[model samples]
Target chain A: MTTFVDIQDVTHVYARAEDGAPAVQNLNLTVREDEFAAIVGPSGCGKSTLMKLATGLQFPREGTVIVGGREVGAPVKLAGMAFQNPTMLPWRTTLDNILLPLEIVEPHRSRLRKHKAEYVAKAECLLAQVGLKGQGHKFPWQLSGGMQQRASLCRALIHEPKLLMLDEPFGALDTFTREELWCVMRDLHAAQKVTIILVTHDLREAAFLADRIFCMSARPGRIVAEREVEFPRPRDLEITYSAPFASLVQELRGHIAQARAAA
Target chain B: MTTKRHLHLAPWIFTLGFFLAWEIICRVLKVSTFVLPAPSTIAQAIWEYRNQLAFHAMHTLWMTLAGFGIAVAFGLLLGMALGASRLINAGTYPLLVGFNSIPKVAVVPILVFWFGVGWVPPVMTAFLISFFPIVVNVATGIATVEPEMEDVLRALGASKRDIVFKVGVPRAMPYFFGSLKVAITLAYVGSVIGEQNASNVGIGNLLTRASAAFEVPLVWAALVVLAVLGVVMYVITALIERSMTGWAQRSDMAAA
Candidate 1:
């Protein structure tokens, strides 16, 4: 498969207030088309920073990040993102929040007014896909944490971006809700075949969803280990209880533990 | 339904009780009405000079509203500019703080001297007094929107304008309204204070004239009118806030 996103040896550093060390150094990654990839690490391991770099929210200090065969210079509109908090605007209905990127990003921006009804239908459809069909008029605060995250995922997909970046998107939900959303997201990735770069601490989540998991060392984060899950397509919760899935999760956990100890 | 009915009459019952207690205490103690007239005396004075008080109140109300409108306009524009630019905030913050600390009421006399006995001085005073809260609140609101949310928007390839209009402004609404409630009251106070010093007609001027003649009851009557006006304005602003934030409030209630 062709690489959809390619990053050379990239380095990122935050200017320390009291002259502390760098944040991340010499990071390199490539996500192939329709690949479900996960970056797993301990807290503050720069996994989130890697997601930012991948999505073009930030540029590397020393290397290039190329998405779809072009170097990323500014923020990219060709990707969607969701985070732990969901962070949907309180004033807007769920449908409106989902349609936000379409109203803002080009090709659709100029056509939004002319096709508002159609766009709203699309947003509603995405909401329905995420099991939020009748709740489109509800505001962010009206929904539970899990429901909000589901809506957020719908919002991310509404623009039909080729890449979806999730930063701890399930972290705030309870175990049950999180597992449910994991299935929802898995079904989504299966149906759409969109390239996904999920940053998560849950090794089980990574093992269940990702085709490949990249474990990172602590900040200045570097990819310390890469593991490929040879699971077949259309994975379900049953796979999480299987022997191979447990072993893979345990291995990833070991890598994270080793990374934490080394840091 | 019970809560609704209770809410309606609760304040009135307390007010009536308060006035009754005050009237009884003064009358029973044989306290002179000169210092603090019985509520009935103040009410009577208000009835007697209804026309004069109304005219003066109109003056104060017009000045307050006009100044408040101007202050909101300038505050929003300046705040948007500053909020959109970190460099501007750094540059203008100290200057704003310096200007804010200059005892704005003390400058009222100078403003009157500059603009003379007209609406301009009071209007300017109201603007000066009300502008800061709006600017600070709006800027803070815009600044404090979740950074991760902003990153998400930016990643989705939203323009700067989109980011401001969709994320920054809507996020700032609660903060802006909070400041606006406070600003409206301050605007009224500013207009009244300015009128006291400079105007020929206004609630503030009425109070000044009554004080000059030592017509204490009449002064209290004008104060009562002013308080009522302030309350009416506050209630109206609150209604506006409720309407605008209905979605957010309902959502919060549901979540809670």
Candidate 2:
């Protein structure tokens, strides 16, 4: 498959940060079209910075970030994003929250009022896919954390963007819920065939969901290792219990430990 | 259930008990009408001069509402402008603070000078005193849009206008409504101050004339009327707030 996203030796520094240290330096990575890519690293290792760069929320200080074969100068309208916090607008119901992107990103923006029924139906379908079928009428506060996260996922995919950027989207969820979402995510990737870049600290989560995992080094983050999971499609949660899965997780954990120690 | 029912009745019971205590204290101490009129004396005065009191009360109410309406429009516009741009907020914030710090009562005379002794002074005073809170609250609401939430929109290539309308304005509704309660009350104080110093009508004017004539009960009656008006406006603003921004209030607070 052709590369859908390519970051070439990127470096970025936060303008207001007191110490003036670059958040990420020499950060080289690439993801193929429709590939599920997970980035694993130690804390403050610029995983979030990389996500920002890829989405064009922040420009790289010294490198090129190309998404869908075009250099990202402004926010890439073809990308959708979600973070650890669901951050749903409290006033809007789950259905409306999921439809928020359409109100901003067009041709939907221009057509939303006229085609709202069609859009609402699509949102309901997404909710059902994520195991939240009838809960769309409820507000964000009324929903549990897991349910909100599910709604958040539905929202990210609602615009049907080519690239989906997730920054530790399941970081705050409990273990059972987190694992349950891993299956949801697996099915979403299979069904949608959208390119997903998941930045996460959870080694097991990374190993379970991603087809290829890129492990990064400590401060001024750069890729230290890349491994491909040879597991077949339609992954089961039960496979996570196998010895091979544990060893893969252990290997990723060791890389993170080394990255942390080196800093 | 019993405790909840008691909580519901608490405000009315307390208010009645408070007036009862005042009436008892006045009767027991035989306080002079000039010194401190009894509740009964005030009530009698309210009945005796009901027409004059009603006229002045209506004047005060209209003046306060007119000024408050203007403040709402101007403050909302200014607040949105301030909230949307960091440059505008930084440029005007210090000046706003300095202006707000100056006693609005002190500005009434200047308003009177410019507009003459009439409705203009009272309306201007009400607008001046009440607008700061709305501006501050609305700006806070817009400025505090969670960075993560903003990222979701920005990633969609949403415009600055989209960010403001979609996230900023809605997020600021609770704050804006909250400020209305404060601004409405402040508007009353402002109009009353203006009425006392510059205008020939309103409760404030009635107060000045009655006190000068030693009609102490009439002064007390006017104060009671002002209090009732203030409470009515407050309740109205609060009800509107509840209807508009019920989403922001937690269930516990909403119950209260």
Candidate 3:
């Protein structure tokens, strides 16, 4: 498979000392096209910094980041992001919040005024896909935490970006809600076949959603290990309880433990 | 007097009771009309001079509004500039605070000196006094934009202007509205300060005119009208805030 993203020995430093440590040091990672990849590490492992670098939110102090045949000199126009917090604009209704990116990204942004109804329909469909059908009139505060997250997903996917970056989008949810979202994400990934890079701290979550996992070392983080999950498509939540899945999780846990020790 | 049927009327009931107590106290102490007129006396003054009061009140209202309107427009632009640029914000925030700290009333004389004892002094004073809160509030709202939200917008190749208009300005709405309420009230104070000394018109001038002539009941009457005007403007602002920034308030009000 052709490499969709190639990061070469990236390093980044914050100008503000109060922001704490330099985020990344000699970090290198690669993911092929159509790959469902997850990055897992302990807290403060610079996983967030990695996300920033990949998405072009930060220019690397050293090394290069290539995504979809372009250098990440600026934030890529063809990427969508959903963070841990829903971060829904409180002023906008659920549908309007989902429609926000369309009003920003070009081609879509230019055409939005002329094709308002069509875009609205697309947003409604995406919202419905995440189980928020007919709830678009409600504001962010009106929805529960789980419901807000689902809307967040819809907003991220609204423009149909080629690259989807999720930074623990389900981290705030309860176990049941988290599992439900994992299933939703799995189906979404399968259907869209767009490359996804999920940055999470949970190994089990990584195993469930990702086809490949990148384990990171803490404090000025770099990828320490890369492993592939040979799970069949359309895997149910039941698979997480299986012996094979347990062994897989245990294996990733060991890599994470070693990375933590090495740090 | 009962709380059950007319619970909404309790504030009015207490207000009437307060006026009755004041009248009784004035009668019991045999106070002169020049010292402290009773509510009944003020009411009589209001009736006798209704037309003059209305005219002056309108003058004060519009002058305050004109100054306040300028403040709102200028403050928003200045606040946006301060919020969007780290250099500007860092340089000006402390300076603005220091400027705001100088008692606004002190500047009224300077304004009068510059503009020469007319509507300009009050209008300029109101603008000067009222704009700070809006600047601070709008700047704060823009500066504190959530990092994740910025990332989301920036990832889509959004320029600084795009991110600001799409996220920063909309995010700043509640803050902008909050500052408007505070600014409008302060504008009234500024106008009154101007009218008290330099201007020949407005309710503030009327207060000066009546008090100087020792028409105490008329002074009391002007004060009542001023209070009513303040309440009316305040209610209008609160209503605008409710309609515009409902999302910010929904969590608290929803349960009620």
Candidate 4:
């Protein structure tokens, strides 16, 4: 597969960079087209900064971020993002919330009013795919945390975004819900064939979903190792109990622990 | 069912009980009307001066609403400006607080000097006094938009205007309506102050006249009317808030 997102020797400094440390220094990473990539690292490892740079929410002080083969100077219109918090607008129903990006990103923005019925149908289809069928009419607060996250995922995919950026989207959910969402995400990747960049602290989550995992060092983060999961498609929760999965998780944990000690 | 019914009737029962206690105290103490007219005497005075009371009350209502209308428009615009930019909010906030701190009653004389003894002073007072709460509340509502929420839209290459209208404005509705309830009550106080000093009509002017004439019961009746007006305006604002921001209300609060 062709490389869709490429970052080269990127260095980013937050305006209020605490302790005079850049958020991410010499951050080099790439994800191929339609690939499931996960970045796992120690706390304050600048994984979020990398996500922001890749999505063009923030510019790197030095080096380049290219998505879809173009240098990113502004927020990439083709990217859809979700965070730890679902951040659903309380005022809008689930369906409307899912349709929010369409109202902003064009050609949908221009055609939204004229073809709202079509868009609504599309949103309902996505909702059903995420196991939130027939719950579109309710406000977001009416749903449970896991349900809200499901709605959030549907929202991220509704505009048919080419790139999906998920920042610990399931971190707030319970363990069972998290595992369920992992399955949901696995199926979504298989069906949609969309590029995904997941930033998470959970090693099991990374090993379970990502085709390739990038491990980063603590403070002023930079990728220290990359491992490919040779597991076949249609990964199941049962594989998590296998010795290979535990060893992969242990190895990733060691990298993080060493990175933390170096700090 | 009975608990729910009691909850429904609680406000009435408490209000009537308060008045009954005041009436008993007044009668048992043989308190002079000038000191504290009984609720019964105030009710009698309200009946006796019903026509005059209605005219003044209407005048006051008009003045308060007019000032409140202006405040809402100006406050919303200014609040948007302040809320949209941190620099603007910081630079203007201290000035706003200082201006609000200067008792609006003191400004009534200044207003009277500029506009002279009429509706203008009362209207200006109400506007000045009421706009602060609205500005603060609306600005707070907009400023509180979660960074993650903005990122959801911003990541889609949404414009600043899109972010404001989609997230900021709708989020601020609850705060705006909440401030309206507060602003309306402040507007009444402002109008009354202006009327007591400058205006020829309104309940405040009537209040001053009745007190000067030693019609203590009439003065008490005017105050009652003002309290009732304040409560009615508050309820109306709350109803509007419920309709507009039902999503923001918790289940218990919405049910209530």
Candidate 5:
């Protein structure tokens, strides 16, 4: 498989006077073009920092971040991002919120005013894909948390980005809703074939969704282990209950425990 | 719906009840008209001098609006400038606070010297006094744009101008409207101060002349008119707030 994103010997420090936290140190990882990967570690172990570096939101102090074929000096425009919180603009309706990226990103930005109706239709299609049919007029606060999370996911993919970065997108959701969204994410990955990097702390989540899991050590965080999941595509929620899935989760848990102890 | 109507009418009922209570207390206590004129006398003075009172009140009303208009224009632009740059904010905020500290009443004399004591002083005074709230509110709105929101927008290649127009400005609308409810009243105070200290026209001038002549009833009448004018302007602002930024208000605020 071709390497899509490659991080090389990256070390980063946050604001010294304020946080004074060394977020990541000497981290190296590679995500292939066909991979669905998860970066899981203890809290404050710089999983988020790793994601930020990959997306070019935060530049590494000592190493290079390469996406596709270019070095990242600014925000990587080809990536789609969804965070733990939806952070939907309060003034906008769901449809307008979903259409926000198109209004900013170029090529689409240039064509948006000319083909306004087409874009509106496309946004509606996305809303429908997330099972929010005809509810586009509702504001963010009016919707349930799960619905809002779904809308956020729709927003992330609306630009048809090559790389999807999910920073615990389903972390706040209830267990059933979380599982439901896992299926939704699974279907999306199977259909779109986009490279996904999910940053999470849930061992079961990492074991179930990712084709490969990269376990990270404590801050200053570094990669300690990499485990390949042998699960087949279009994996259902049922696999989460099987013996193999439990063992996979245990193995990831073991690495994380070691990471916590080593810190 | 009926409850909503009752909610709306509660304040009006309270105001009328307050006036009635004042009238009864003054009559029962046989308060001197010189010190505390009864509400009936005040009402009679208002009716007897309706033409004069209306003329002065209208003069004050238009000047307040004019001054407030200048303030809105200046404040919004300055606020945008300040909000956009940290260097400008650091440089100007302390200066603004100092300016806001000085009494506009003291400035009226300086303004009169420059503008010859006509409509100019009142308008400028109102502009000066009412300008700060808008600047502070708008600047804060721009400054406080959520970091996550900015991060997402930046990831999507949104320009600073795009983020400001689409998110920052809109986020500040509730604040701008909140400030207007205060600034409008301050604008009126500035206009009256300008009139009392310098101008030849307006309710402030009328009140001054009435007091100098010991026309206590007329002074009281002017005071009543001024209060009503302030209330009317405040209600207008609240209405605009409801229409423009109803989304920003909490359910409790909407109910209140």
Candidate 6:
């Protein structure tokens, strides 16, 4: 498998002080095309910092962070991101929020005026995928928390980006909604074939959604363990209760506990 | 006519009650009309000069609207510009504060000197007073957007123009309307003061003339006209605000 996202020993330090505490020190990771990977770690472990580096929202102080074989400078137009909060613009409706990327980024930007109806149809389709088909005209505040996150996911995927980065996207959701979103996301990846990098604290979430999980240490986050889930595809919520699933989650939890102690 | 009697005649009940008591006291004490005209005499004066008062009231209304329109335009453009530009914000912020601090009424004489004894002085006075609330409100609104919201746009590679027009403007609408509601009332007061300082045919000028000539009844009538004008402007602004922020209001309604 080809490595689509390659981070070559990246180090990120905040410029304000010399506390000798970097956000991420000598971090290296590569995500292959069509891979579903999760990074889980102790609190304040800079998992989100790694996501930022991968998406080109922030540049590493030293070394190269490349996505799709190109050095990340400004944010990549071909990448999509969803934060823990939906961060939906209150002014726009669900349909407009989903169509935001298309309106802002190219080759969709120039084509938006000419292909508005087609793009609207595309947004509607994505909304339907996330179980918000007819609620496109509703504002973000009108929807529930789970629905807003779903709409935000649609916004991220609207432009058909190659890489999707989720930073604790389901952290704010209820347990049932979170599990349901896991299936929604699983199906999305299955259909889209986009590389997904999820940064989460929930061991169960990592075990359930990701094919592989990378566990990291606190503060200056570094990979402490890597585990692969050989579970079958189209994972239902029922799979989380199986013996193998429980073992994997517990094993990852143990690694996190040790990492926290060491920190 | 019955509804009118019930509604319009309601205020006079108290006024008539006070006057009847006053007339009884004044007749007993023998107080002069120059000091406190009897309610019957004031009513007679208003009935006789109703046409003249209406003409002056129309002039004041036109001046108020003109000044208000200018203030809204100036406030929105200046607010958006200062809100958008950090350098401009830094440079003009102190100046705006200084201008706002100076009692706009103190500048009425200067406005009169510059624009002469016509409608210009009152219009400018009203603009000076009314424009600041709108500018401050709009500037604050534009500045208060959620950082996370802007981040999403930034991460998506949205240009500054796109971010502002698509995001900032819509988000700032509620604040602008909020300010405008307050501003419109100020505009009316400012314009009236402006007209009072120097104008040929307006309620303010008539007020000045009435006071100078000791026509206390006409002065009261002009005050009543001013109050009516202010209420009308306020109602129009409220309607506009309701329409502009319909989405937000609907959300609040739903939450309720």
Give the clashing pairs for model 6. Answer: none
Sort order, TM-score high to low: 2, 4, 5, 1, 3, 6
In candidate 6 the C-alpha lDDT for residue A230 amounts to 91
lDDT of 1 by residue, A73-175 (tens): 9887889998998889888888888888887778998999999999988888778888888899887877888899999999888888899999999998899
Model 5 bad stretches (over 4 Å): A16-21, B1-6
Write out the backbone clash pairs for model 3.
Answer: none
* DockQ winner between candidates 3 and 6: 3
Indicate the worst ten consecutive residues by lDDT in candidate 1 chain A: A14-23
TM-score of chain A of each: 0.97, 0.98, 0.97, 0.98, 0.96, 0.97
Q: Which residue pairs show backbone clashes in model 2?
A: none
How does each model score on lDDT?
Answer: 0.87, 0.94, 0.90, 0.93, 0.89, 0.86
Model 2, A1-263: lDDT tens per residue? 89999999998999987899999988899999999999999998989999989999999999899999999999999888988999999999999999999999989999999999999999999999999999999999999999999999999999999999999999999999999999999988999979999999999999999989999998888999999998888889999999999999999989989999999
Error of 1 at A262 (Å): 1.6
lDDT of 3 by residue, B1-256 (tens): 4645476677789889999999999999998888888888999999999999999999899889999999999999999998899999999888888999988779988887888998998898889999999998999899899989999999998888987888898889899999999999999998888888889999999999998898888898998998889889988998998888877885634424
TM-score of chain B of each: 0.93, 0.97, 0.90, 0.97, 0.95, 0.82
Model 4 whole-model lDDT (C-alpha atoms): 0.93
lDDT by residue for model 1 (B14-105), tens: 98999999999889888887888899999999999999989889999999999999989998877877787899999999999888888777
Cα lDDT tens digits, model 6, B129-155, are 899988888877777777666766777
Which candidate do you rate higher for DockQ, 4 or 5?
4
| Local error of candidate 5 at residue A75 (angstroms) | 1.4
Instruction: Encode model 2's per-residue lDDT on B48-108: one tens digit a residue.
Output: 9999999999999999999999999999999999999999999999999999999988998
Q: Against the true structure, whose DockQ is highest?
A: 2
Q: Candidate 6 — which residues are off by over 4 angstroms?
A: A14-21, B1-47, B251-256
Cα distance off (Å), candidate 2, residue A205: 0.7
Which of the CAPRI classes, incorrect, acceptable, medium or high, describes model 2?
high
